[model samples]
Target: MARQVQFDQLGGPEVLTVREVEIAPPASGEVLIRVEAIGVNRAEVMFREGSYFLQPAFPSTLGYEAAGTVEALGEGVTHLAAGDPVGVVPAFSMNDYGTYGDHVVVPASAVVPRPPGITAVTAAAVWMAYITAYGALIDEGGLKPGDHVLVTAAAGGVGLAAIQTARRIGAVAVATTRSPDKKQALLDAGAAHVVVTDEEDLPTRVREITSGEGVRLAFDPIAGPGVDTLAEAIAAGGKLLVYGALDPRPTPLPNAALYPDLSTSMFTMFRVTAAPERLRRAVAFVNAGLSDGSLAPVVDRTFDLDDVAEAHRYMESNAQTGKIVMTVSHAPDAS
Candidate 1:
């Protein structure tokens, strides 16, 4: 038996519980992994609260990123073998698969060889944040060098990833956060300028930073009344990629007459994996960034698997500047 996290009902972090579960052999095209670390994301929290795009079934597991070693392989799987280190990508639906467990079975296609020189904790943290940013900024936004890109909520995992991605592409990354304490951290994370939203005007700061021209692109996860603010900060013909709703309020549509040339698009990782070729390109890009040290996983803290609920509580507190991870204690037989 292996320990796994599950929730009987949709609710707060307290709804999650860890229980021992029997491990089953992988079926065709599946790989059984002895999970080493799990990456906690905002998406899981939203799913638990019954506010996410993916609906949760009662007695359901919740997670999308993890790293582990291959303990067993199923029929027709030849790319990996026992003891191979791998990271689980957030390319599948959470309702169909989950990574918050001592062992998990996932499609072989969703597993990528863990990048070298990083711990399992770092590997678990990389895929969801980096891949999501790659899809939104590079694949969807068509970001180019010297362009100014505004990243809202620039202290979370995906926000930091967007900042790094923009810098790697030679674009100016302007980061925003409500807290002044995170200003230096955002700057250290590759943000060209950090805007304290609570103290400064977003659109005005952006306009001044770009020398009266607004940002060429805006990557925002916070949607709501803030949509208008983002719309105002964008340049003519600029694109705004909305990937998440951190605000619980309904997203208000941008004023078309105010900025007719501004295009607003919703982005999700699903768009990156919708095409096999596109998925391949994204993976290659992330791997290259990791190798060159341009892309690094920022881990705020780690908890044992048993303390996952506490990890979730910490995540909800909005005090984290990077990824929160849960480490699984390996069994005696686990490699």
Candidate 2:
């Protein structure tokens, strides 16, 4: 029997129920996946809480990206076959593949050839954060080499991806985290400097680190009321990108400092992934980046498929340094 994590009604992590679901064979241009690992993201947390872009239907399947072996191929599908290793990114919605399941059917566009060097757990976690970072920084933010990127929420998934991507392009990386503990870890991920904003002053610390030149780009996901400090610290004519407001409060832009000339770009990946070709490019970009060693999604910890509630709780705590993941296989025996 094919089993998956589902919620008859959306509310919290506890609402997720893992049970058997009937499997349908692939249609034209789709392929079936045997899930090895699934990524648990804060986006999943937001989806469960009904704050994400899409609302949950009763008994909706959960998960956006995963990786596994190919089980079957649909007609007209090229470059993939049964028994191949691949990453499954469920563009559009989780119902596209219901990747939390043991098996799923996904469009060819949603799949990428997962190289042997990358584990399923790492492959599943890399796509979303990396693609979102690539789109926001290079495609949208117009980041250039020698640019200084100040990334908020530096220990989180996007922050981790941003650090590696910035380093890949030869840009200076400055990452921030609430926990003073993850500072060194961020540096280990190739950050030029790691800022523990909860411990250090934001503007003053950024200025000190940048030697008062200020950063050329600020990639902010935490848009709390205090983000004016970020706006205050942005170097003249630099860009600011706010991808989300994880904080309950809204960011306040002081009019005096909020110059019309300041470039600020905002977006949701859901909107960007709508184009089938772009989705394919996202898959290609991440897969190539991983294969080349320039990008690797950090896996903080992996829980069993049955332990999704604990995974959600852990992610909700915001203490994890990188991607928190779930695997269909059993959790590793403790030491």
Candidate 3:
């Protein structure tokens, strides 16, 4: 039996529960892993509350990222072996397989060997955030060196990853947040400038930072009426990439009367993960960065696997400056 997190209905963090259940062996094209650490994301909270694009089946499993050692490999899976350190990518559907448990069986394609020198916690935190940022800024936005790109909600995992990814590509990263206390931390995270939205006007400040030309690209997660402000902040012919819906309200397109040259797109990491060639390039890019120390995963805090509900609560609190990780412990006789 393996301890796994599950929820039978839509609700808050309190809905999450841990249960010991029989684990299935790896099926063909799948591999079983003994999970050591798990990354917590805001998407899981949306999934639990029934607000995500993908809804859950009753008693649904919940997770997308994990790092562990391989325990077994199914037929046709020859690239990995027992005891290999590995990490789970968020390429597969959560309804099909989840990494919330101490042991999980996932598709062979979604498992990648952990790079040397990265711990389980760091490995668990890397893929989702970096890939999401990479897909939006590089793949979709066509971000280039010397160009300015805006990263909103700049304290979260993906936000910090976006800053690092931009810096790695030589682009100028302009970050935004609602709190003044996080300003210096965002600057320390490699952002060229930090905008505390609560204290300043976003468009005006962005214009000042860009010397009136405005940023070439703006990546945002809070989609709502505020999109107009972001739209106003972009240079003519620039693009706005909206990747999330943290605001939970209606979003509006910019008035053609104001900025007809502006372009907007809704982005998701699946754009890269769902495409074979894109996924390959993205993996190669991130691996090279990790191996060279150009990219680093930031883990803000950790919780015991049994305290997953609390982890979810913390994520919802919006106080975390980086990725929140959950550590899984296997008692000698529990597995």
Candidate 4:
């Protein structure tokens, strides 16, 4: 029997349950992975809380990103072999086939080889975060060289990835944080400038920094009333990517603040992973960056599996410095 986190109800982290389950061998085009490291995202939280676009049936598995070694390959799966290290982007649905488990079965197409030089934890964290950022920054927003970017909730998983993407895309990254303590953490994570949103006038300061030209893009994950800050800071014809509403309140928009309308688009990793071509492109892009040493996933902390509840609580408390990963079988020997 394999163990996994499943939720029978929609609510807080307490709704998540680790239970033993039976799984059949992989079918054609599928592979079974012995999951190692799992990346926790805001989407999983949203899914858990029943606030996401996808409604949950009782007793559904909960997770989206993970890295592991292939345990078994199903018929017609020729591209991979057992024992191959792989990264999973499990955005297909909220069903039993998720990354937060001891073993998971997925289509071969949903699995990408973990980059050669990257660790399992980092590779697990990379798939969803990097792809989400790429789809929004490159494909949707058309982020270009010399464009300035402002990111809200800039210290979280996808938030950190957005900052790295901005750097690679030749954009100036100005990241925001509600936590006064994470100010330095943001700078260390490749942000060109850090704005502690709760402490400063975000729009005014952003305008001052860009000399009134404003940022070309604002990547907002925490879409609450705070979105107004980013909306006001965008340059004319800029894009505002609203990916997540971590805050419970509806996002604010200062309607009359800008002359030309600020271009805004809804972004989600689920959407990024919806089509096969998009998934392929994202895997190629992130893998290439990994191969060349240009991209890296930041894992702030790792916890043992039984401590999963603690990890969830820590995440909700917002004290993490970077990605908070959960290690199942193979954690680095701390000694």
What lDDT would each prediction earn against the true structure?
0.91, 0.81, 0.93, 0.82
Stretches off by above 4 angstroms in model 1 are: none
Q: Rank by TM-score, highest first.
A: 3, 1, 4, 2
Query: Among these predicted structures, which one has the highest lDDT?
Result: 3
Across residues 1-335, which tens digit of lDDT does each residue of candidate 4 receive? 78888879877788777888998899998899998888887667777878887887787887788889999999999989999999888657765467788788887878888867688888877877889888888877788888898888888878888888888878889998877898888898899999887789998999998999899988887777766667789888888889877777966554655535777767877666878887788788889888886778788889866666677778878877678888887445499
The TM-scores of all predictions, comma-separated, are 0.97, 0.92, 0.97, 0.92
Model 4 C-alpha RMSD vs. true structure (Å) is 3.1
Candidate 2: misplaced stretches above 4 Å? 95-97, 252-258, 276-281, 330-335
Model 2: what TM-score?
Answer: 0.92
Predicted candidate 2 versus true structure: per-residue lDDT over 1-335, tens digit per residue: 57888887768789888887887788999888988998887778888888887787767887888889998999999888888988866475754446777787777877878886899888889877888887787767778899889999888888899899888888999888888788899999999988788788888888887789778889888787656778766788888888888887866653454654467656667554767676666666677778888888899999998898899999998888889888886335498
RMSD of 1: 1.4
Clashes (N, CA, C under 3 Å) per candidate: 0, 0, 0, 1
Candidates ranked by lDDT = 3, 1, 4, 2
